[model samples]
Target chain A: MIDLSDLSKSFGGTPALTSTRLKIAPGELVCLLGPSGCGKSTLLRLISGLIPPDTGRILLDGQDMTQTPANRRPTAMVFQSHALWPHMTVARNVGFGLRVRGLPRSEIAAKTEAALEMVGLRGFDRRLPSELSGGQAQRVALARCLVVAPKVLLMDEPFSALDAHLRKSLREELKALQRRLGLTTIFVTHDQEEAMELADRIVVMKKGAIEQEDTPSGLYACPATLSVAQFIGQMNVTLATARDGCVAWGGRRIEMPVSGDLTLACRPEDLLPDPQGVPAEVIRITDLGPLLRVALMTPQGEALTWLTPRAAAPLPGARIRLWPRALHVFRGETLLETIQPQRLTLEEDA
Target chain B: MRRFPLGGLTLLTAMVLAMLGPVVTVVLWAFAVKWRYPQILPTEWGLKFWAEVLSRQTITGPVLTSLALASVATTAAALICWPAAFAFARLRFPGRQLLLFSFIAAQAVPKFALFLSIAVIFLQLGLVGTFPGVALVQGLSAMLVMIWIPTAAFRAIPPALEEAAFDLGASRLRVFLAVTLPQAMPALAASYVLAFVAVLFEVDSGLLIGAPKVTTMPLTLMTLSAQVVVQDAAVLCVMIWLPCFVLLLLTRRFMTSRGIAEGLGA
Candidate 1:
């Protein structure tokens, strides 16, 4: 287990990481998700001891490792740039950590071969870094870290340089490798879909602080704030007036418990066209093979989108009606209302 | 239709011939047995002049002396330049820009003016006629240019390579030796060659401080020029130019192989 408490760092008088705390269980794969310049990489550097924190205590396996340098720490990082040494061959690069630890040449060679085999680079031991392709270079970097048998593996956008198809394949490969080794890992990225697909738990960050941390499904289904909802996926926020167990917006009222002003969120796929639903006008329609994105303007001039199985073949400037479920409500950054799912009663009981 | 500009090619050929004319004339006169006033060509040709120059023991000693001094001076300059170049490329200490500017200024100043004072200092230290004294003088003058050009080359290397080495648990020294130095070898070789050639022909300090006791080919050529006719002086001049010519040939070969000429659009 690794724990960071009150971690903070600054570069040239600018705060890179503010006071932050996080905990990772043994063998857990947690991802730090944020946009660019959101301080996710800074946190990883601090944990790996690449840069010392201004104020913090890092505990690994119940031992204080705050003052330990990077070489002494049982942590390794695969940088976003893949920082492979161009001068060394693949085998030497993988065995660098062992050589630094004063291991025998035979032991270093054996461990290096094993690590290379683990990363599916068994025959590439004699090749220089420049000889490898982008994906192969990343695999060499991963092998370099794995050879050390570090307790915690830190990756900072390791797949960002790869093409989309390769990225998907490598992520699965990395996940499988992590599970087999049972290594506790911290993966950092600005990509939301990657975070959702790979992380057991995702930590959403904004600026220098974490906004929310939860299972990927939980964060997606129940976002904590407007920022979290918009960052994680497509969100259409509508302002509404709340009064006496009902919310009213754009000339439509929905039955839900409300206490004050509120914001409503609905996934694009949830909204649909119904002849007897609230009146709306179709603004634009885009077809995307498996789905269609339909944009509509309400009578009060509020714009929204809904996804359907087929393109709505309505003519331009046609009016339509959409019935969407009641929005999850939040008041002043606090969860204020959740509408229970409506149930249809049987006529036999009646 | 546009006519081909034979005029430009004619002008370029003329420029090349103009540069080669004087050296070609000198080599021809050096080999002639005799030439008199108003004669465009020699009256006779023989190896007598070459034999005279080659057989002189005094001339041979100065050639050896000059070779030794230049070799030692160039090697010393390389030793002093490497670390300074590395630091100038990598580190940001206080007064870095000022120090770098000082080295540039040292290269700008003419060596003759500095040699006068350096001679007095050498005499005071009782090193007036020694090989080490001449070498030290040449090294001091050549150090700035040797170090600065190579420092720029080293700076051009990607810093990512060094960072990668460090992340792999290598110390700073190991990173420098394993990565940075190998990448900068081509530049370092160029700098050493340039410094060696510069020191080989240096005469100002050597003549000013160690003329009577310590001798070099350049000082000997100067003496021979003053005593003999211009035709006789040509032989000594050709002899002195031979080694530098060979060195220039070697540099040209290196420059071609390294694509430095192509890079410069030469």
Candidate 2:
């Protein structure tokens, strides 16, 4: 239950963040995903009151906290570096916020114990920060935030510091913890897979602007723009000229709404090897664990990737036919429409 | 308990002894009343200078004055430096590098030249021959070290730690006190002690402004050594650092980091 309105920020005279309006529902985990310098972290900092936004308002439960300092805010943040006070013991680290608030020692200790238990770090209270592993440190940071019972939790790439295996386990634990507590959380990360795995809604950001905000599958199935589709998955994007309510590509014509010259893209799974379809030349086949990916060049020299089963993978340089089950068409980065399987027609190879 | 490198250990022992040779000489030379040129050790030792240094001697008042001034300078400079050091190391602002460079640039000025100008200024301000005036100048000279050490110490702490403290509802002051300062305690302690000793070593500024009324240890050591009063100078030197050795031991725990910041892939 956080709402940001008309937020825009500039760093050293260059626009670093721009937001129009965003509403995160109670207990909803929203992920801010983008490349580096995309203003995802800037947005988080603005919300956390670490930095005041140049223009905008942050509403927590309908109270404007835009001008409030971080200490006055009801939100807490878990840093990517874990940020556990190295000199402090785990219990002391978790209790730091409470201590700052002037809470009683007994109460702080009790809450810290409960929080650590929730993160499965029950016996680590007496250990210093330097004594724990990367994952443990992160859990301590989580417990520290959770102990405060923040209205909203902010995490900036909190799992990026760990090994892949540790990251996966920690991410699952974090997600589970958030779900159990029903915490309204804003997590920032550049990892698409992490966003998909953790977020109830993913806010795809580009150049300080929100590109698309949708559920993971919703975004993957129907991206609002070319950038969203390109960012989310392995895709086969090709530029096509739309003419007279028909699509022209690779010396082939297909029935479709003629908007304008546009770019077309689809997931690798969208392209299916089929009989009774235009033939294409397979350039290479990669043996991915779950699916074998076949790379093919259309007659017009556009390369497309098709994911076939490992058992059904075609050889490299093989002449094959591919038909699309669904494909997205975009006009200058904006999504024009997604042409479903029923609307597509395969043309013969030149 | 572990396997010892015998040859390496012998070399290390010789190096340590060689390093302590001058210090031993200073101690022995302070007590020696009769010693010739080729003697390896003092043949006859006397306690005349030691008694004089302990009992109202020219160096007595200087020693006390130096300790008091150094204490004040170190405390004041430490208080001033840590916050500035944190800002210098952490905050990004316009002309940050330039500002830090100005502080370091002050260190490049020779002590005598800087003291000459400072003494003239202090005299006009009616602060000449005053303890506060002398201590203030000592603080300015010591501040270069004060800023540099804690800046490094503060830099070693991840900003995320301070941010995390703030994100969890700790104010900026609370963040510095609770998170940054505790983590940087060792550096702060090291800087404070080094600054104190640095003040004790300063002669030009103290002599220029504090003489004829205030006599700090360095002024006495400087004049004594100039007059070839090596024994008394050596005695004064022992008095200054011997007590500090205890102080250092007491604060030694603060100098070492609390068991290495774990889980940071170290």
Clashing pairs in 2: A130-B262
Candidate 2 residue runs with Cα over 4 Å from true position: A341-350, B1-18, B31-37, B43-49, B79-99, B120-130, B151-157, B222-231, B246-252, B255-266
Cα error, residue A111 of model 2, in Å, equals 1.5
Instruction: Name the lDDT value of residue A231 in candidate 1.
Output: 87
Query: What lDDT tens digits, residue by residue, belong to model 2 across residues A1-350?
Result: 79899999998899998755789999999999999999999999999999999998999988999999988999999998888877778988888888888888799889999999999999999998889999999999989999989999999999998889998888888888899899999999999999999999999999999988999989888899888888899878878777777886545566776657888787888777667555789898888899887888887778888888887777787888777877788899888788763535554547
lDDT of 1 by residue, A278-335 (tens): 6777788888788877888887778888787874566547887666664567776655
> Each candidate: RMSD to true structure?
6.5, 4.2
Taking the candidates in order, what DockQ does each have? 0.23, 0.53
Candidate 1 recovers what fraction of true contacts? 0.22
| Best of the candidates, DockQ | 2
The lDDT, on a scale of 0 to 1, for candidate 2 is 0.84
- Runs of candidate 1 with Cα error greater than 4 angstroms are A240-247, A255-261, A276-278, A311-318, A331-350, B1-60, B117-130, B157-159, B207-212, B217-266
TM-scores for all candidates? 0.81, 0.88
